[model samples]
Target: MHSLRPCLLFLLLALMISAVPVSAEPPTVMVADYTISPAVLQPGDVGTITAIIRNTATTATVSEKTGLPGSGAFESSKSTDIGVNIESVQLDSKDVEVISGNYKRVGSIGPGQSIPITFLIRAPAKDGIYFPEIWIDVTGGQSVRQPVPVNVNTQIALLKKPALTAIKTVPEAIGPGDEVNARVVLRNDGQSRADQVTVIVNCSSPSITQKTPSTFHAGSLLRGENTSIDMVFLTDKNAPIGINRVCLTISYVNPDGTITSQDEVIGIHVRGRAKIGIASLSTDPVRIRKGDPVSLVIRLENTGTDNANSVKATIDLPFAGNKAAYVGKIEPDNDAPAVFSLQAGSPGTYTYTLTVQYEDDYGVQTREERLQMTVLDGDATGVVIAGLLVFLLCAGAAYWFLTRKKGPGNA
Candidate 1:
C-alpha cells in the first residue's frame, strides 16, 4: 500500500504538469510592398507615403532605408523614410529645413507577414532635382527598395512644357462670387502627342479650380490639333474691382522622350465687381404705296443687371426721306419704343439700319438693328392722270344732258 501511494502521487504530479499550456514562439516578418502618393514634388513641398513590412517564419526587427542621395542637387532625408538609427529629415534643397515637423515616420515598420506604415516628406526650398529612396531591411526577409523624385525649380518652371498662344476667359465681365470658366488652347507645334504633360493655371481668385492634368506628354498631341482645359473661377464674396490676371504653365513630353514646358498670362475685366448688363433691339416689316408716307415703331430694352445712364436707340431708315421720334430711357424690366416716319417715293425694296448708343460708369455701349419694307407702284402718276381724265368726260356728258332738257322746258 505504501508503494501504491508513492506511484499515485507521481501520477497526480504528471497529470498536473500535462494540464499546463505550452508557450508559443513569435512570428516571422518581411517588407514586401510600398506605395507613394504623388511621388514627386517641388522644393519646400511635402508628400504622403505608405509602406508594407512583413514577418516570415521567424521573428526579427524590420529596418527600411530610402534611396540615398546621388548628387548635391538631389537627396532624401533618412528621416523621410529612415529607421530609428537614422532619424533625420534630409533634402537636396537647403530650404526644406525651414519648415519644421513637415516630414516624419508615423509608426514602427515592425516585423510581420506584411505591415503598412505611413510617412510625410518635405522638399527642399531651393531649386534643383532630387530622387528619393526607400529601403526595407528584414532580419530574414529580402530587402525592399523604392525611389521618388523631387523636381524643385525656384524658377517655378515645369520640366517639359509645350507651346501656348494664349489663355483667354470666356466672359471677361464676371464679378466676385460669380462662376466663371476660362480656357487654355494649346497646339502641339512640336511633333509629339504631348504625353505626361502637367498644366498649371492660376487666377487672382483662389476660388478657381482647373480641370486639366498637372502633367502630360507633348508627344501625345498632334500638330495642328488643339486641346483645351477649363478653369472655374469662383469669385470671392468680396473681390476687388478691376482687372484680374490669370497665368498658365504647360509641361509636356517630347516624342524623343524628352520634356519641354512654357507659360502664358491673360486677364478679365470686372466693371462693378458684381454687376452685369444686357441690351436688345427689335424691328418689324411694313409696306407702303409709292409716293406715299409710312410709319413704324421700334422697341428697345435695357435688360441690364444694373442701371445704365444716357441710353440711346437708333434704327436704320429706308432710302426714302425719313424722320425719327425720340424715346426715353428704359427702366429695369421695362421697355422703350421710338416711331419713325418715311416718304416712299420709289417702287423698290428699301433697307434701313438702326444704331443704339449709351454711356454708363464703365464706358460707351452701342447696339444696331436693320429695318426692311417694300413700296408698291403701278405707274402711279399715269394711273392717277387717266382716272382724272375719265372723271372729266363723265362730268361733261351729265352737264350737257341736264342743260339741254332745262333749256327746252324753260318758259
Candidate 2:
C-alpha cells in the first residue's frame, strides 16, 4: 500500500504540471522618432506633435517539448508572426495644454513595422523651455515612453548646423576626343552660413583630363543661397567606353571655424564613335584602256576609337562587271580592302560616285564621294594592223610599175 501511494502521488504531480500553459517571450516595442510642427512655438500658439513607434524584432519563436520517459524526447521550434496591439497612446502635457488628439484602441504593428500617432496641443503662456513626454501601452509587449523638447519663444537654437548640397549638370553622352562642358551648383540648405567654400574635381582615369582649372572658390554662401561653377574637361582619343566616374570634394568653414568636407560623384557616359573613310584607291592595270579587263580596289580605313562592322562599298560607274564589294570589319587604326573586277567601257573620263556603308554603335551609316577615272582609246593592236595592210598594198603597186618598165627596155 505504501509503494502504491508514492506512485499515485507522482502521477498526480505530472498531471498538474502538464495542465499549466507555457508562456512565450514578449515582443519588444520602441519609439522610433517624434516631430513637432512649428518647431518654435509662440506663447499661446497651437501646434501638432507626432510620435512614431516601431517593433524591432526580426522573428517570433515558440518552443515545445514532448515524448515520455525513455522515448527519445526532443524539442521542436516554430516561427510565428507576433504583432503588438496598441491599446492607448497619451501625451503627458504638464506645461502645454492638450487639445484633442488622444488615441485609443489603435490597431496592431507587425515586426519591423512602425506607426505614427499625432496629437494637437497648445503652448503655455510663459516663454521658456519645456520637456513633454508621451506614454504608449501595447498588449503582450513592452510599453514605450519617450520625451520631446518644446520651446516657447526662446533665444536658444535647437540645432545650429550647416548642410551643403551639390547639384550638377553634365552632358548626357560624350564621345572620344570631345570637349565637355559641365556645371555644379552648390546650395546651403541649413540655418547657418558657410565660409571659404571650395570644390575640387578629380578623375583617376588618365584618358580624362581637365581643360580648365580643377578647383573653384565660392568664398561664402548664406542660408538658402546657391552658387554655380563652370568646368571643362577633355577626353583622349582612346578614352574607354561606358560610365566614367569623377569625384568632387567640397570643403567649407562653419560659423565656429570648423572645417567640414564631403564627396559627391558624377557619372559621365562615354560612347565611342568609329570614323570610316577611304584611305586610297588603286587599279590592277596602271593605265586602263577601252575593252580591257580591270580590277579596282578601295582601301577603307577606320581612324576612330571603335570597330566598324559589315563594311561594303559600291561604285556607280558604266562598267560591265561586279559593282559592289564587301570589306568585312575594319578596326580602329586599321584598314581593309574592297575589290571589284570590272570591264572598261568607252574611252573617256568617267565621273562616278563611290558609296561606302558600315555600322558602329550608332547603327548603319554611309559615306559617299564623287570620283573620276579616265580610259585611253581602244587597244593599239587595231591601229598597227591597219598600217601594215597599207604598206603591203603600196609595195605591190611599185613592184608592178617597175616590172612593166623593165620589159619595154629589154624589147
| Highest-TM-score candidate | 2
Residue 282 shift from truth in candidate 2, angstroms = 2.9
Candidate 2 residue 250 C-alpha distance from true site, Å:
1.2
Please list the residue runs of candidate 2 whose C-alpha ends up more than 4 Å from where it truly belongs after superposition.
1-160, 170-181, 234-238, 241-244, 253-259, 267-274, 285-293, 304-310, 346-348, 359-365, 374-381, 384-411
Candidate 1: regions farther than 4 A off = 1-31, 56-112, 129-186, 189-326, 330-411
Candidate 1 Cα RMSD (Å): 20.0
lDDT string for model 2 (30-65, tens) is 778888888999999999898888877757666655
Per-residue lDDT of 1-411 in model 1, one digit per residue for the tens? 877998998776554433212332333333366564554566667765565545444332333322323323322222122222112222223333322222333233332334565556676766666655555444333444555445555333334334434445478577556766776666665433566656666345453434444333433466557767665656664455566676766676665677666776656655441121223333233446676766666666665533445565555554454454455455545666666666665777778667667664467766666656677883668888999999999999999998988895593
lDDT (CA) per prediction: 0.53, 0.85
TM-score of each: 0.28, 0.51
